[model samples]
Target: MVNFSLEGKIALVTGASYGIGFALAKGFAEAGATIVFNDINQELVNKGLAAYEAEGIKAHGYICDVTDEDAVNALVAQIEKEVGVIDILVNNAGIIKRIPMIEMSAKDFRQVIDIDLNGPFIVSKAVIPSMIKKGHGKIINICSMMSELGRETVSAYAAAKGGLKMLTRNIASEYGEYNIQCNGLGPGYIETPQTAPIRTPGHPFNEFIISKTPAARWGTPEDLMGPAVFLASDASNFVNGHVLYVDGGILAYIGKQPK
Candidate 1:
């Protein structure tokens, strides 16, 4: 029998106050995993707690910045003490800056890289040792479609996600022997509060995204639930060092020819 059950597992999803991260955590809870999440501040953590409670999931929420190495290390230790050794980790915390490459300041570029790329590195590093000792683990990096494709006005975001893709592969390479499977979960243009403005009907970007996607619509947070659970569950034990892109076939299809 293919085992997709996450029972007895503890999952730590970073930046799960809302958006995709929250959805993923909720899915894990549905699959029987104890959910633990973190946000950058107390307010966000509180919000996340409230949201989880509203959903009937008693998730443990914490305030920790994923970019701070020491803070992440401490957070991991605290989770180990409070919850249990995390069996699954989802590095879902990140930010993007859509400024054109030429106009984007170096400071802004570094900020994107630091949060999107380095943050995962730090958090993953903090958790791997315990995972190694425990004999098995799953690390899912929340990558992006930009990891492979680039476009105008998103230079920094593209660069960060590109680096993150390689980082996901490298972690899998370096830790596979320890029974740790590290992979990337690349989401396509998802329908979130952040994308609400652009998704209005007839909006140019909305039209562009719909035309580009073979599904002819933006993906919902629900679209990623099953895939994320598969990657986090034992069903993907043999799947490592690969990226599972949930991009509504956008990556696989070329846009329709002009009528």
Candidate 2:
């Protein structure tokens, strides 16, 4: 039987205080992996802890900004000492600036790139040595649809995600010899609390998305569970440098014809 279980493994998912990160970490827990996560601050970490506790999962939570290289390295060291050497690293922490390209400030652009692009590089770097020593690892970068397609008000987000896609492939190329599989999980427009307003009936953006997507709806956090687990487990042992887009068929379609 093909094994999909993550028994006896340690998974570290970044920015898992809420949203997609929290959901993916929860999935790892369900798959029998020891869950460890981090956030940029204590409050978010506390919230994440409570959320995981509510689900009856005993997750290890920490406060560390993925954008801070020193903090990420220290966080990895602490987790190795406190939990175990991370067997799976999920570079899920990210940010977006929805300003138009011409109107967006250089500072804003750099901030998004710093967290979304540089952050993954830092966290992944910190964990790879341990993975190398252990002789196996899985690194999942939370890429976005913007990695392939661009939008009007998401100049920086698109650029960062695009770079992340390449980074994902490069890591797999560099580390596959050590049994490390690096991949990207690109989530489509997900309906979270932050997007609740725009998802209301008759919202132009929501309608536009529904019309564009073949699945005709926003993706749920639950939709990412299986894909995340698969990539983190032995099920995908031979799969490396791939971007699995759990986008409800949006990327496969060109949208409906005009009315």
**Can you write out model 2's per-residue Cα lDDT over 10-84, one digit (the tens) per residue?**
999999989999999999999999999999889999999999999999999999988888988898989999999
Q: Which residue ranges in model 2 land beyond 4 Å of their true spot?
A: none
**Which pairs in model 2 have colliding backbones?**
none
Query: Model 2: C-alpha RMSD to truth?
Result: 0.7
| Model 2 weakest lDDT span, ten residues long | 91-100
Tens-place lDDT digits, model 1, residues 1-259: 9989999999999999999999999999999999999999999999999999999999999999998999999999999999999999999999988788889899999999999999999999999999999999999999989999989998888988999899999999999999999999999999999999999999999999999999999999999999999999999999998999999999999899999
Tell me each candidate's TM-score: 0.98, 0.99
Worst 10 residues of 1 by lDDT: 95-104
The true-structure Cα RMSD of candidate 1 reads 0.7
Candidate 2 has an lDDT of 0.94
